[model samples]
Target: MPELNRRALLIGGAALPTATSLTPASANAPNNDEAFWREIAAEYDVTREIVQLENGNWGATPRPVQADYFEKLARVNRDTSYYSRRGMGRDLMAVRDRLAEALGVPSDEIAFTRNATEAMKTLIGGYNRLTPGDAVLYADLDYDSMQDCMKRMALRERAEVVRIALPEPATKASLIAAYAEAFARYPRLRLVLLTHVSHRTGLALPVREIAALAREKGIDVIVDAAHSWRQLDFSLPDLDCDFVGLNGHKWLAAPLGVGIVHIRKSALSKIDHDLATAPDGPDQIGERVHTGTLNAAAFLTVPAALAFEARIGLDRKSQRLRALRDRWVVRARSIAGVQVLTPDEPGLYGAITAFRIAGKTSMRDNGAIARQLLERHRIFTVARDGVERGACIRVTPNLFNTMAEMDLLAEALTELGV
Candidate 1:
């Protein structure tokens, strides 16, 4: 087994409350609006200057969660004996269980991983358990990490990888049928790795029906929920995938070094026990994934982040993100010759949106657009210059951003005529 490198200091010198005696700004009720977010904004100490639109890249830890994490860390450092002797792993899981409750899944189904990449890699790497000649299916629109892992499987395990292009700015039926056709063609495909939401185009995959259909085909599915958790309000039962890899840092706004992997209870029977010897309860999924000596601080603080979202609530955050996307899209699309690559329908995208900009009709033009945005505008966004869409820009919005900031982005694109 490769040694898992420990994480940077997630815990520092700070004080944590005895228990989370969480207080609402107003104990009786909370208002869900820009004002509410502003009040709670102090919880996360963002860097001094710059509008951060890259939560999709890395999330800054909130003040309360970071402080609590560091305080526990200091306590552990003070008496390594006291911390190590008492079985700290047993204690930390009560925290994860609380997160499980908030996520609407049973405690036994979720496991902790550092990020979605690790979680997805583990699932793809373990193809040794799969039947011979079993295939893996994905798309050109997926995060490159999973696509690369699939390539590795082909090299090592002799499994075939089938890649499909999501219909440009797809509809629910077309998206579902795209995968259905792939599965029907390759009945030997034992597993499907689908993104609940695309990291690249901000496209939302129709997972529920897809999951049901795959089950009928005897192909287990693993969902990448990097952009889905807290982006919308729904339960694990709703999407119904066999396995899911979630990033707390993205939408949940948790501190870094924490991610959750939930294996649907029905699919639990297929995973081998003793995968890792990390401590967990009798039926807890933590035991299945826990590698020794990880920072449990991020895992513990997720509830705080979720609590923050709960105060603002999921529906409102989602609406806010959609509204923000709409604002940016309208501005960008208004520029002559610009094409909004992301779907306008509410179901197709959220939190992230991408647009094809007018330029030299090449990927290089896309790269130039991204570089110009950052160098000139001080606005940060992800850009891609690959395959179908030559030059494109990805815009993402979070709770902390304001309309004025997005207007600035609009102004930058307007100057460029793209």
Candidate 2:
């Protein structure tokens, strides 16, 4: 196996690592070397019977991380409350420190939650700065639960709910313009929910640009970065948002039930404390979210997950994912009756991409397409709705996946597209 030189990693256009930087050996070595990626694929234990492309729900924990998690689980089972009451707090804090460092934020500004949904709920529900007649905005592509929460928050605060539709076949300029238009149309907008990566269409939004637009209008932005954190090579500072909800299990490949809530230290007071009493007081980020009796093993295994990713390097991981996505999307776009929903523009997409067959906009139609791919082609995918345009089949490939698998998916879609 070829050894990866850490010094060769360099981030380039649209935040993706340059191809030359990804070469493991001499400059002549191909960035997308099949032999090197196959070695990386060996770290995961996936089924051989099927091509698993639907990895967006949650990532499969790497073998090493899984082993660490099992060990922690057994230790917690043996010690029970004796361990929980004594050293668990300290251990958890250390985990938070490591996570905070990875995310480029202070340890005190982040807290753990069961998942991104819980963290987002905390940020959206606990936002207490709204006044009567103020408005909160969300788009069709935002998570359904988060949108519902925004509506409920509006009702509670006597604020208006401004729901908008993102433009289909969107461009970077159009996406930014859409938000700017919304902010202008709703002068009283107090808050907006921004999904850094739309789960429905796999559309990667220009978060920092959109957040900047929201800020000019004095609207607080709560970013749902559930799918973007490790999948994209970016840090918290790059987003420039005050609050964000991140998922560890998704791209980080951590054990299930681990998520992160980030509230910038300067903006901590904007979000009210969790309903549960905070013994640590209002200033502490942990007080902002209270999920009682979390899965200790899952939380304990996060450092191991981070370690595995560090070994591979986020720049390489992200570039490899995009390469896999492009392998299929470029072919799918040329196929008859297929519409690739996510744009190929740099920084506009990542590993996750969605496509729709001609005239198959209904949920049932897309669902059947997903089933067909599974049953006939032995490939796994998911049907997603809630896009303003229509339903689509979402394809997300993990680090374990190979170029051949992507090619197989494209061939399957060609057969089904007709």
Candidate 3:
């Protein structure tokens, strides 16, 4: 393949004749205007081979960000340890500062990890306040790894692990009530894991309300915002949680292997330092988790991703994504034998949503349904399990996705529903 086609295929899964060939939108075009979105879509090199609705895994870095990543990768490769040991620290700190500004947190409170999984692991394992007989709570919607970490910590500290099931068809008030009830029922609950946006069904939880409830009960909440930071228009303060784990690759469109760990300055004492010592003192947030070496190129490319998101504006991006989500979900809900997992209420969902055909609740059933959608309709989706009720098929669209693709998915579901 030619160099242009090669890069396009590598990043977007297909070659575009020329990304710029698409007509530009008017400067005054409304945010929801398809022409405006098409212009934004032109920034990415999307595959023509299939309708991609599985963007929840990770975002495809825009061409500009990808170019910046390649340049940084080349520089790192050429400079090697000489640059890494001497000059890279300053550059890394610069990236951290920029990311901190974007997240509305102090630079000292946030640390970069390979991904949210590593970030949350450091927070969960390093948490030192738990005591024997005290309870640490999590819900069925929490990520599997974090759930396991909570269980392990409970085992190690002799604390009780309390698992609750979030209410289905959850509303803002009902969601808050669930946590309030949990907190009241488990008086010994010292810590709780809250997922801002569930990876299983894309149910966006009211983290701020739930955290406030936990706070009133003297419970500390650690939020898994791996899917929410950029997917939804919010900041760390908006969540009201002192500790959070987020991802850049999911919605910020940075290269893979970039994640964040945020521990409020005042709350730092709650988490112990990593088992591995660092040259930096224990007072610094960087010492919380020592991953040793990371993809310096990926971390360095974050500024470019932030810059891209800045130009588009996070608020506008959130609206655009929600519009795409609602476009299909409205149709899918009306189809007989189809069950929409996430509610239609505002602030409860984003670009990610899930659905299942009635009577198809097993992992095998949903997996087959997802495969059939791909094979028959060329619409791609993923099967998700562990939603307490049963398995589901998650559909996630990114900035590059067209509204028509969501309709294709709805149509596919309709056919499958029969």
Worst 10-residue lDDT window, candidate 3: 1-10
* Runs of candidate 2 exceeding 4 Å displacement: 1-30, 278-282
Off by over 4 Å in 3: 1-28, 278-280
* lDDT, candidate 2, 64-154, per-residue tens: 8898999999999999999999999999999999999999999998999999999999999999999999999999999999999999999
Kindly report the root-mean-square deviation of model 2 from the true structure over all alpha carbons. 6.9
Superposed model 1: Cα runs more than 4 Å off:
1-33, 40-43, 127-129, 273-287, 359-363, 385-388
Best by TM-score: 3
Q: How much lDDT does candidate 1 score?
A: 0.70
Q: Report lDDT (Cα) of residue 327, candidate 2.
A: 96
Q: Would you list the C-alpha lDDT of every candidate in the order shown?
A: 0.70, 0.88, 0.88
Question: TM-score per candidate, in order?
Answer: 0.85, 0.92, 0.94
Cα misplacement distance, residue 158 of candidate 2 (Å): 1.5
